[model samples]
Target: MRIRDTGDLWWKNAVIYCLDVETFMDWDDDGIGDFGGLVQRIDHLADLGVTCLWLMPFYPTADLDDGYDIKDFLGVDPRLGDVSDFVELIRTARDRGIRVIADLVVNHTSDQHPWFKAARRSKDSPYRDFYVWRADEPPPTHDEVMFPDEEQGIWTYDEQAGEWYRHRFYRHQPDLNTANPQVRDAIAKSIGYWMQLGLSGFRVDAVPYFVSGTADDHADGLDDPHDLLRELRGFLGRRRGDAILMGEVNVPYEEQRRYFGVETRTGDEDDVQGPVGQELTLQLDFNAMQYLFLSLARQDVAPLVDTLRARPAIPRDTQWATFLRSHDELTLDRLTDEERQEIFAAFGPEPHMQIFDRGLRRRLPPMLDGDPRRLRNAYSLLFALPGTPVLFYGEEIGMGENLDVPGRLSVRTPMQWTAERNAGFSRAQPRRLVAPPPDGGYAPEHVNVADQRRDPDSMYTFMQMLIRRYRECPELGWGEVEILEQPEPSVLAMRSTWQDASMVTLHNIGPEATTVTLELDDIPADTRLVDLLQNGEQVIGKDGKVEVTLDSYGYRWLRISRPESRRLL
Candidate 1:
């Protein structure tokens, strides 16, 4: 049971690139992306300094929820490629020291899945218990529903079975009865299957709903809601102790701790992190992401400060996944209506761009109006935060979205490779391609890797430089954060220290120039400030404080160095 790992702790400081295989590239003329194209493009990721690849759901599906409605948990989609192509892709990625992760969508499956189909056919079917079904009509009204834009209710009646089935998301995806023992075994089987196929871990979807039932919710003899998650943790640990399990639990910030399980040694009596790992290795910091948008809109740092203070302590081994955008909409559900409206007015002025009254269906560059200084400032804050940063594909070159593509699909267009047919993503005709690629200013003709790679000031080059600098400073990923108090509310500053290494970052969130002095008593009096982001150097003042003047949206990253410790690692 004590399997040894590389002990690289790679996930902590990793720069993850998330992409959908089907929209990434298409080598065949089938008008869809395939693994053959992905295998050939592994070198591009390696060149970008990517450490991990987070693949969207590629399992067999019924064209529902963009493959999240998994129909076959153990097989790859035939449209993408055969099993051998997946193996070759993983092998190719491994050769460059990159690890791959996939989505584990266990919350629900397509209603057409064999288990669900068989269960709905007869009440006596062995698989009947695999899904949650009620003999009586469900409650007329209920909360705790997702996809309110598309789903009318949480429970839908099934005439064939003469009962109601529960679904947290789309009606086509019926929630699995995770409390059942056989269902738990089936989940374990899925984990083992992918691990054996060379995947490093999985991005667990809808985690809270996985354990939604209460004491009375399971009258058919099932384990407690918490047991299933604990079992999944133990199962993965037995096979590979360093396995990563990233969860997406969209709940209140305080409630997220339950999903990030506590890992403590027996009789230790301490909730602090230890060698033993628990439920989730990393959870997306939705609270911080949502608050950051508020801070951006108001040009104030109070929201960010509050979010930091409210952050519950996590196990030392566990980390957070921070991102500017992902496959789904940018969620603002945690903010108040007034706050949400203010942000909507500032970033998403268009009515159709805002969706479900809780999210923005546009990309970051478009929201910022393609301002280069603001772009650098916004992304600088993202990378400086206390988490592993994730970059959505094509964002390095500042790709925009297609508003007319419908729903969240507006942001899920194919990757723009160059200024060619189909934006160099595929050779297929425009009508047969995936979600339409941007055609105007953000089209491949104007913005793409081929053009940005040669420009020194392009976002692509900036990212390469940023990643190299990030890898040199391990403290950003594992350090303790302390917010520095400043007189100006629009200026944000913080100090991050890990052991003997210490660095300070400052940013002007507003549109006006600002001059602020940060008091520092812990640093040595003789220390000098060496800018890590290629800025000039400056000496500490006699008052034990440093003063700097910043233009609108300007930022600085300075490392505290005492002559002997001034060089970058």
Candidate 2:
């Protein structure tokens, strides 16, 4: 799994696994997951076909806003082990074919940081300009503040400095002033420190909030953040030639191209688009996921297909990191309240939806009780989608959301390795769970790695089989996607071909059984189609028409090739 061995070397065919190190493993029984604990799980990740491990922030923090409130960029959070532990985890993961990507929070630092402490002491301090501050007037009020209920505004007044500093997120996490040359240089040096340690890459958090406009204006302005990103990329590129630096630029799809340094029309007056430097390796496809979820809940597959067809063509080297669940909010803001209510009505009170505040919570289901078959169909769609797939920590074992717990902590529960006490996560008492279950009832039988591994029909096994099959066919890894225009709206059909082999993924997502007729006029006359999921259960007519009978939500990947060509080979 050397970086150079892969074609694009980006997350092209990579399967990423997201882990919250603070809550992932607890090796010392202190009720906190540490790097040594993560190092212990390296083999599990490799066995699960994970090529890259994207860890949430593991830096020194105040523990108020999870790990996002960084107190020290150079040091690891003591609760999650020290520098030695991180280095060991990196070496262990790399040896097991896993590239580790850490979270880089450049937008802000914790108020507890030494630099912030020095800046707060005096307005004339050398570190005063490290963060965005205004002495003449209050800081800008961007749109409606992110936490209006919790805070009065985006800027907080400092009595000592007699000025207000900008903060896009929590007030404790003050936004860094990227406009300052010294601040930029210091951040670059911090990145270089990690690069020198042989870490794979980074996931830049809240990249667009690096700079700000006026107090009355919420606009981000025409100046792309690429100037800062490019400077960081250039410095890192010089040191580590092929390492990646993905930005969490969660903007509109049209604005995504700018991250790749491509200038295009933004449909606004006097707002010409400019390039944001950096290869634009990956942009989280929230729009695509939104469209898919909406279509599924409404039972209208046309919109999903149309959205995929209308997607802007990205560079061959670029890729979308697809996921059904991640460490973020589950319900995206793209959907209207009406749509959300409709889904809740149909799905019948999902645990995560109980406290879902305007769609700002992420949680997994405890079990596939309602529609296990439909869940399997969704998994099929995820794996067959045209992007690198990312599996959330407990998704493989059908881990459910404990909505009883507050915030996104419910979704960040420990990995259920066994049905033992604490689900084999920690040796601590049941009441000591960092994210305790709402009702104090553990889902020992329903959600555990040992039980699922022994069950062949488990979601974990299904995912493993799909990944193994995908690896067996290199065409599916890197090939052109040609979606077939099928008459049946509920069926998703696509073809991936390379050289002499062609792979067709057909899925029936509808509630009723359907038969798909595929004309072989375009294909070779002697071509033989082999169903990988259902062995030899296919019928091909002499009139060059292949009829496939699929059960409700059934899917199959057909390996189509000429019989004579296969025999000769």
Candidate 3:
């Protein structure tokens, strides 16, 4: 392991784009996305101003759970590419200033994994402890199980071993016995292998259940993954300097803050920026995301305001990964039943789009019915919110989902590059393709990159404009966020301050046009609201208040800089 305090912190100022390799592009005509295709398309991401790429998973697997079920940790999936292709992809991507982070799915492995296969052969096998096994009758802990939609219970009877095994997700994926020293060592070794592969870091999957199980079954006690996370953080730091561990802990803001190393593994224990250990460098802000959709669903902004107000403190080095949608369904579990129902009725009216009883399996464009204004507002809010923003694949061009695909696979369609067959993704026949692209209104012929690139008012261009503005205004990501006091319940207001710069963003969540008055007493009397987009401008009134008029789903981002004499331009 190598340790160095590079202090690069490139992720803090990065625009991250997340995608699955199998769904991005196909280079070999093998009917699947591959490293060669991704390499060929690196310029597209670079042109979009993406500073980092968060890949879902490209490891060898049984093609279950979107590559979360790992068959080999150190090698690349033969379908995607070999080791040389991945290394070349990284090198080429780096040349364009885009760092890559692959998914880390250590919580469980496919039953087809060598260790699991070996362990099932006999209880006396040395690999037996690599996976959790229940000698006695398995406990009834369905309430805490992660995947209630797919799994029945935590234990599965393996006839080969004559014992029951624990699995938090699908039955084929057995939970790894992280409590074992050898198992822990193997996990660490996997990390080292990837680091040596020249990866920047990993996006940790299923963090909450990483340390859960019987006390003897876990190196750390049940339901507490802090120690393992800390160990992983330390290992990352030592093996490859400045590599980050972005965790997927989707709890509310208060509980989610613990993933950033501010809280301890034990009960209510914590140390503020302790020197000894650290946890995840980045955690997805599920609180903001859940409430973002809720606010939109009810056409009310209170849910979002409440979530932002309840935000917890994180270490200065830590950041929250902001996103609109991810690999799985967009879950509204954090909200109340009534609130979730309101959202489901509005966005996911058809029951086919909902999953896990609290999430929507569809993408944003179709959910909003392709209303450009609302989509722009939501995307604007995501970029303007605190922490680093994570853009999902094809979200930039307003890609739609395919409900025909089962489970959460609805959103995992092939990238529509052109209007040609297979959306210019592959030359293989439709039957040989991995997963079909959207059909009907969202089909490649209707909505594709080739069409949007020529249209100035397209979502593709609008996303580019958003990214340009986001990069131009660093305060939105690196500065402090303060919720503004506005009388309009439909309008959400907030201010970001950093160094000598301050920015204010106002978003209207309701369907009706309205005017809002924000109390700007704290702002200097001479400061003016400069529209960063060069579209509109307003001056502070002598009464220490600012009035904003917005359309049904309008949003405004204003920069408050002391101009020449504070006079109106």
Candidate 4:
């Protein structure tokens, strides 16, 4: 069955931009960003050429976990404007040919949520089964707590319920029991309700934790936990044929494949059947992201090349979401201790710049020391990767993180729009702003949207160019990646070929300019290499080799142009 009735899976080539309502823009001047302010900035996103806007939970929350501790799944936080404002934002974004997807935080809920509050009230309460609970003194298990810096254990004793409840992340946010049919139905209803309100899809939070049910909580009917994903996928397909479910499952490649669904076989083991995408439409490539930072840290592209080549092949409809920096910390937990320290030494040398002993609480600009060449090269590689690219809110303008803020919030500062008060995010006082903008070199005065928009060579304009070129080259998004062999260890060379179209991209991650000759087999001699970033083309020699020169930390996106072929998109 076709996943999308449109015949075009938009996500395969979509550019996703993620932002938080409380930090994006403040229209009410209450020091907090709202939908009203977001609406005013929809044009900015359109101008940036993003196809998908991933909204970080604007739901009514207790405001403890950066909106992830959802108090009400169906209602928008009054602070961020009412339901009407949300609908208007969706409408405006849609009018600009952009699809909106919300953060689905059903893995857990705020302890203050009505259901959780009711569950804690009595032992036999109807909502008691809404959460995972253990009656006796919970024995110590080897289940590692998510936040070792704060929480010491995953199970927290609840005095009200007279039992120990499990929480994968934080104590204030309790995990919901998916094993319960009613709870599963409630989750499905929430998805349907949001889709009815015009959301294209969801960025499902903590998918592994959401599906990993406890042994004691097992039930009949849904024997395998993955069946729940199949159920949700089927429901989404029926409700909206093109809607997607992007999951945040940061597991090993093999384990990650399970979340994408298994190969369906009707006959014997030898008689294998075709594969089916019964689960998530897309997943974040945490492994590749880690290797990317490692490559940047060491100024060597071997790690990244290895990681990309190691990725497991999945079903056609499913894809990977590539990102450099996200809303959370730049997690390096997937890497080895030695590799993690190598990144920390290069990027997060100071202790304050590190977080949770596993990741760096910084953005790419600051990590790269605000070097424009390096930043441009990094973003170039991001778009050239073999997946849909995702950009954090402030990435386009080269925003830096405020290490003063504690933990991951360091990177979750307000958007810098201008050099004026509150960085043009709001009219409120500096103290009242949602989160203070970065100070010093990377402050709003030095780096902002207004200033960058005016500068022709600004990072914002560079990002716009990259987005434009990326949209033009569909091969980069929907093609087989072939890592081209080159001499320079600091240069990453690769080719992406989709059908009749082919493109070759090269990145010099080092600080010195160099030239590399690549052997392009199968292509006819004297073929022209059409440069996508610049206004020139190089002809391939008769030996099927081409010499390309690059500046320090430079990149090139060249489309193979054969004689008499007139496609120049």
Q: What's the count of clashing pairs in each model shown? A: 0, 4, 2, 0
- Candidate 2 lDDT tens digits, 251-312: 66666656655433564433333322354566666667767766666666776787677666
Model 1, CA-based lDDT: 0.84
lDDT of 4 by residue, 468-514 (tens): 99988878877888999888999999999887789899999999999
**Regions more than 4 Å wrong, model 4:** 1-7, 141-143, 211-217, 221-223, 264-275
Prediction RMSDs, each to the true structure: 2.7, 4.4, 3.6, 2.3
Which residue pairs in candidate 1 collide?
none
Candidate number that wins on TM-score, 3 or 4: 4
Candidate 1 displacement at residue 103 in angstroms: 0.5
lDDT of 1 by residue, 15-102 (tens): 8899999888888957778899898888888988898999998888997688899999999899899889999999999999889999
* Candidate that beats the other on lDDT, 2 or 3, i.e. the better one: 3
User: Which sequence of candidate numbers ranks them by TM-score, best first?
Assistant: 4, 1, 3, 2
Whole-model lDDT per candidate: 0.84, 0.72, 0.84, 0.89
Candidate 3 clashing pairs, residues 3+ apart or interchain: 2-238, 179-219
- What is the alpha-carbon RMSD of candidate 2 to the true structure? 4.4
Which residue pairs show collisions in model 2?
25-33, 364-401, 365-400, 366-400
Q: Clashes in model 4: which pairs? A: none
True lDDT of residue 551, candidate 1: 84
TM-score per prediction, in order, is: 0.95, 0.89, 0.94, 0.96
lDDT of 4 at 437: 92
Best by TM-score: 4
